[model samples]
Target chain A: MQLISAACWSTYRIFVAYILSLAFGIFYGVSANVSPKREKFMIALLDVLQSVPILGFFPVAIAFFAAVFQGQRIGLELAAIFLIFTSQAWNIAFGVYETIKTLPREFGEVSKAFNFGPDFTVRRVYLPAMIPTIVFNSGVSMANGWYFLMASEIISLGNKQVKLPGLGSTMMSYLAQGNIWGVIASIGTIVLINALLQIFIFRPLVRWSELFQYNATGSAPEWPTVVDVLSGLGRALRIDTFLVSLVSLGNRAYGKVAKYVIYGIGTIVAAAVGYLLYWLFTPPYPWDILVQIPTALTVTAMRVIAAVVISVLLALPFVIRSVRNVQTAQNIYSLASILGSIPAVIFYPPIVALGGRSYMELLSILLLLTGSFWYALFNMSKGAMLLPGVLTEMSQVFNIKGWLYYKNVLIPAILPPLITGALTAWGGAWNASIVAEHVQFGDQVYSIPGIGSLLTEATSNTKALVLTVLCMTVLIVLVNMLFWRPWYSRSAEKYNITE
Target chain B: MALLDIKNLNLTFRENGKELTVLENINFSLNEGEFLCLVGPSGSGKSTILRIVSGILNQYTGEVLYKDQPNPQPNPNVSMVFQSFALIPWLTVQENIELVLEARGINPRQRVRTALKYIDMVGLDSFEDAYPRELSGGMKQRVGIARALAVEPEILLMDEPFSALDVLTAADLREQVVNLWQEKKLPLKSVLMVTHNMEEAVFLADRIIVLSARPAHIMGEVSVDLPRPRDSRDKAFEDILDKVYSMILSSRLGK
Candidate 1:
């Protein structure tokens, strides 16, 4: 009974967070693409925000919400939701923005030719065009939501901890009590929920969204009977029509005041950043905390590199096998998607128990691997699958085998997605470092010297926490701009295959 | 009065800090009950002229007049068929037609009726519920035609309508288009088509306008006075075809 209730609470939190993320994602995406001028600023801002680890927002969430609500339950709930929002919203918004940015010119012409108003165009054209992207990204966003939901439900700031009544806190309490059976049961429930969500919701959604794809070739796959029944129910209830009307109404209202709202938001964001800068540079600053940032960043960067390297090594075999066999590729994709959704936090207690203090470094790497490895595997497999068949045939005809084949053909073929995956894994490893570098079990606390550990340790001091987050954000964004972006685009340009 | 008129239409594009003139003083007219074709070399801004008349492009000098009025905005009486057959892939043939009708505030029942009528007119009688991706290139263009016609427009602008299709399909669609015009099966008063194919223009057009290469200006216009179902092998048809070809080629050579 306790487990069931806890599961419900956890599910409720995830559902609410997902809804909020979807709304903000569509709004942000549309706003970003409203004009070229806004696109530059909005895209750059999103890039910076996306690089910041989800945990980096914890201090700000607590500082604002906890202060505003005066440590009430509502404040912590909102903080938890905000943390999940940070985890899920960025990629979704990016997906929507990209869909809008790349929409075919003829569709826009058709809309204009038909004299579609803003509301009608959005309802019929823009929204439909974005549906496929939104649906695909929703699955990834939900997975991220789960990971952060587990991390956020049991928030710890120095000695003070606020635990919410969810599966995450339930599992934490079970571990604290050394109730192995209880922890296993909670994990079982989580796995069950993930399976149910995949089977009932996301699978049908993916199938349905295929209809919305432009230039979609070949016949669509058959959907399950449940989808038919659900669609029938929706039709009977006039749900689709109701939703379309709602969008039209909302867009009409938004169109009237969107300009002023954008300006208001710009002013508010500027003021907030100005205030944050002012607070950071005030006299009697935490110079000691500032001094630790460089070394801590170096340590975390090394670990992130190690994590990405290990993930690449581990994922290469699977990628090769999956590429060679279609059946194996499909199986691997399904299994990875399911396994990848399981949060790495679930394994923390077990690793802590086994390793204690001596194996902290090894266990940290293991946890980081769990967090980062799937991105490499998924992307590399996708890249390999997308390899033009003629290249392989050419290699066979030319008798290019063994190391020669891998070096010249395979390596170049997968280079773009490989780089993409590695970049994402790099970011994932950095985010995982927060939970990986520091582990707390009951009365014992295990720590490593890294930016993550520094940030976690400074949670009690809002100023120190803010400063560490800022430093990490700056470092990550700089690395992405200076290194990853250039490499990614270069590889994409060089290795692009046209069929 | 001309059904549609373009007077000194000029378009220039600013790219990489350099001003590139795309169209220079293009002039043409489409009369009621006439099939007009604009023939030119590829990238000679022939399709750009169609886009202007369709109201998809408006940043140009001079004016586009419908019924001798200064029409600058998109007119509901003007409908277009695209080279790529821009049917919304998600919507079925029926729904794609209805979408335009819906936008024009046609009631649901009337939308279905008008959409079906055009769908049947294009001989897509049983493919009402089929999405664009499911149809062949020819069928998709048929849907595009049906969609444009369902609006009951006075002017039809086709931008290389059959260029994306296989040769046999393009021939069949061209015949069907001529049939539709000759049989008065649609509410269309005039059609202005843009194509680079001299043979295609001779086969279907009542009048052909030849354009020069980039920074395009009208080189000349050829009027076809052939009988119904004009054969490409007929002497008159080939003569007009030769005339259009020479006009385009001579302009290319700065003659």
Candidate 2:
């Protein structure tokens, strides 16, 4: 019955998160599809949401929710779900927006030609086209839920740390007690549940999406049934017919309240920025608190080097193994996924028990390096192998063999994916290192002089001044410009191998 | 003597949990240096016939003979140009042609040289280093033909190779293909092509094999004895086209 209760809670929260995120996604998608002007705003909002880690808002949410729902079970649960909701929301919205915007040109023209009502158009043309995307995003949303589980369950606000009763809290409690078996059990349970859900539900849903699976050749190995079921639902509901009607009605009501809504949003954002700027200017600390600038630079340099070296070493052998033999590679991929889901914090106690705090920090840093590198290498090797068979056959025919194959064929083919994967891995490792360094269990204390540690200390101390500065200056403008800019430009030029 | 012989071929495919025969009791014999065009509407098992002969589709039950012998091996000497052009988009014109050599383990430098010769022959010498994306439809078809010939295959199977091109480009390409066949004395023992275009069949094929509607069989075969470089304006060519067109139309309307 406890298991049933847990399942029920899990299913309800998941469904609520799913539906809310989907509704938001559809609203954003419809607006983007209907109005060209709204597209940029929608995309920008989604970008900001994606870049802002949901955990970053935990402090704000905890403070707000505690005040609002002081004695309610629903309030605490809702607060816990809010972070998960935020984490899952952006991906789902982006997926829907992409689906709607990229619907076949013919469908759009047909809707216009028929002069269908806006409601009819949306119901018939748009929603049906998006079934596969919805299913795909749901799977991704569920995946994102695993990442946010621990953080959502445990929130340290001022002198009090609230622990919510869920898998996340259980893991945290076991880890804090330095109970190795308990930690293992929780991680094992979470992994098992996720694996089962993925295999049974998500995979099947994806498979049922026949419209998207038109030419089922060379589709990346997906658990397909989730998409398949979503498609079946879309068909059963006659959503395509309804979308056509909605589109027609939407066309008629296009400009109504649109300008006022835009202005209202613009005003709020401007006021927030203005307030933040004022706060920044009135800081009590010496502007030399910016000594952390060079400190950050040094940490970044160390992190990148560690990440690159470790990632390459770990990935190289696995990649080679996978390329030479596919089954081994698949096993590695599955194991990596399970490992990837288990948070860096979860590894703290075991490492501390073995090597003490300082050694654990070093070990975590190395693990961080491995985590980043393996992901990139595995993806790169897979991407290279997954290049259209016809292209591969062409390479084979050219007598491009052995080391020459790596140099001329695999290297050129996999370079872009490798770069992108490396960039993603680097981002992931940096984030992990921060949490890994700051959080410790057992008879050890470890600190890494990095942004992650800064984030940890700031949150712990309730240092709003540093938080705001880091969020605005370091996290957004500098990080994107310095780290992600070059990669984004290269991605635009080269990553379109599929087309 | 027949260069290739396919006897009582039966091909079945599953649809909605039931086995549907795509090709049944299909028999054909082709002589050396013969150009046979299999003309049919879409899904007439014309492509299936070619696939079966090429050994890509081994699900069919039948005997396909090569040089009057029971086929013990899949036809390695057969090269096919798919309806989609199937040009490896990442490869350059020269490299695309060189693929056959590389696959067969030819030296790189020599492969490039041999590849360039064919690239020039296809009037794409200037585009040798340019990827398939850079090439026009006709140019890609030229590369396709060159790749097929590079392997020195005994039989060439072209599945609507020119159908995707504009009429002028298709006609121009057809002319070049015929010219190359005449000049090179290439060891193309037989050519089996699937096309819907009546004039294309008449122009290129020695024997035009017409296929019935879906679940297709050979309706009939017409021999075009017109001389080489048969003009589109020529009366004999028009007559052959009209006859094939009427046959196809009647078959579709009602036999």
On lDDT, the leading prediction is 1
> Judged by DockQ, which candidate is best?
1
- lDDT tens digits, residue span B44-76, model 2: 888888777765566778889988887544455
Evaluated on chain B only, candidate 2 has a TM-score of 0.94
**Native interface contacts kept by each candidate, as a fraction:** 0.73, 0.00
lDDT of 1 at B108: 100
lDDT of 1 by residue, A1-499 (tens): 9999999998888889887888778777876776677688888889898898877767667768888998889988998888888878887888788788868898988887767766677778887799877766676677777776677798764468889999889987887788989988987887788878777776666666768878556665455677788679978997556555654543443474865786798899899999989998897788888899999999988888999999998988888886645456545555566677677687785678677888888888888887788778766876676577788999999999989998999988899879867877887788898888877776678888999889877876778988898889899899999998899879878887644
Candidate 2 regions off by >4 Å?
A: A1-15, A22-37, A92-141, A205-215, A218-254, A286-290, A308-337, A367-386, A415-420, A442-444, A460-486, A489-492, B1-162, B165-233, B236-255
In angstroms and one decimal each, the interface RMSD of every candidate reads 1.2, 19.9
**Chain B, per-candidate TM-score:** 0.98, 0.94
Off by over 4 Å in 1: A222-261, A312-334, A356-358, A377-420, A489-499
